[model samples]
Target: MKHVTKADGGRQPFDPEKVQRTLRKMGVGAEDAERIAGEIAESVPDGVRTAAVLRMIRARAKAVHPAVSHRTNLRRALGLLRSKPDFEEFVRVLLREHGYQVETGCVLAGRCGEHEVDAVAEKDGTTVFVEVKHHVSHHRVTGLDEGRIARAIIEDLQEGFRSGRCVVAIDGALIVCNTKLSEHAKRYATCRGIGHIGWDYPEERNLRTMIEETQSYPITIVAGVSRSVSTRLAAAGVVTAKQIAYGDATTIAHDADIPLKEVLLIAGRARAILEA
Candidate 1:
């Protein structure tokens, strides 16, 4: 057996071109083989053995296409974002418009301890704690599962309300999820003296109407003045920063003649200002 050695006495073949050809034969593409060969040749120790260099080359080739793997991961992440319950901030804005003093992102007691409540709303003489869930699938969630979650939320709220641990008065309670779960949950909630509001899908008219009725004010004040001021204000009654932040951008774009991207940009800027 002949031993190959580099000029520096490294016990390995120094021909990167040969390594690249070997990689190409092992199913690696020409471009990827070139990249892998360069990395291995440049980084491997001069004194390393030929067997070690070969092993390193093989491992590098396998790990080099990580970006390709990331595409699928990114797609899954975007899907989750699209279906996130808090994406629209629906419950938060609805309560604000309806003249209910609202506190968002508050943790409430649950059967298991502390469960986060999306919004706690208090009106003239009644108060309600709301939990919002977003479900994107076409299949509806049965009341059995959703009802249990709702019941746990309501029970936690009731416990807190009775102890006077929080400032808001609890005259009622509600759980708001996708429209599919609304009917079933409503029946269960109503039986227990808890309220349930269903918003099936995004509808400009329905959202506008809800905002108007809840806020006791016109849409113009809720949604900022923009190029499509009159139409958008009339259609959605979005008059305030809070309402605009919570309203659906897709609906706003369709009715207001403003691009969805533009609406989002404006909303992002507005949110930044509000946070500051």
Candidate 2:
């Protein structure tokens, strides 16, 4: 009916079509999404916060099935991860889903310095040195300064390869981040020939779109997936819900060294999230 307050305290005119699009992205049928968006637009007050609208939408999603809410609960789940180590692992798994062979925690010597890479990803014989920037806050943005740093890193890595200081052959550099990118960041990355993936940048190929399309949600998306459980699973290279949903339960259970029953419960929850 009026402007909706964003999480960052900015306001935007309430549009039911936008809500419907979000619902459809979350896998609500087109007819249902339209109906639900219409209902919210009519019922909500002028000053309602966007968070409140999402809560109302989530309630409706859960009415269809408890797991339906998980489809769009990615924001909260990703924010819960311990940013550095956990986020790096999550991105590694996401890259794997997109057909990249990823190696994490790689250290390479540059012409002037040594840089620690979040991942070295290869696909179709092309390799990239990936730098992962993770933000716990929903409102934080990946800015141009981050791009500047990444560009320098890429330049150094290129020099290292040319001079035979770095053993691995790298074709380019990429920045993988959990939040949206600033306009300057996008421009800089493009001008410098650096590949970038942000939450909603690059439109069709952004991180959020890729996650939904590949169904490569982090293991933490499951309810009650404690730090201990995730740590154990990560030790066995199980970082995504898709891995749990499709992997052999017995093997995963043994490899993670957690009980079979617990693994089944986790797998069951992962399956529910995917199939919701």
TM-score of each: 0.42, 0.91
Name the best candidate (by TM-score). Answer: 2
Mark the 10 consecutive residues where model 2 has the least summed lDDT: 64-73
Our model 1 lands, by Cα RMSD against the true structure, at 19.9
lDDT of 1 by residue, 1-276 (tens): 223454345554478888897665344678999988888778866566665776676566557532121111111111232233332354465666657688876776543466666677777767777766555432345354655776666666567767765444456666654434445565666577766554432244233345334432222232233434534433454444444556787887676677788768655543432332
Residue 29 in model 1: shift from native, Å?
62
How far in Å is the alpha carbon of 136 misplaced in model 1?
2.2
Q: Compared with the true structure, what per-residue lDDT tens digits does model 2 show for residues 1-276?
A: 388998878889999998888776666788888889989999999878999999888787566547774444686677767776777888988888899999877998889999998889999999998988888885788898877887788788889989999888888888988888999899888998889999888998998888888988988888788888888888888888989888999999999999999999888888988887
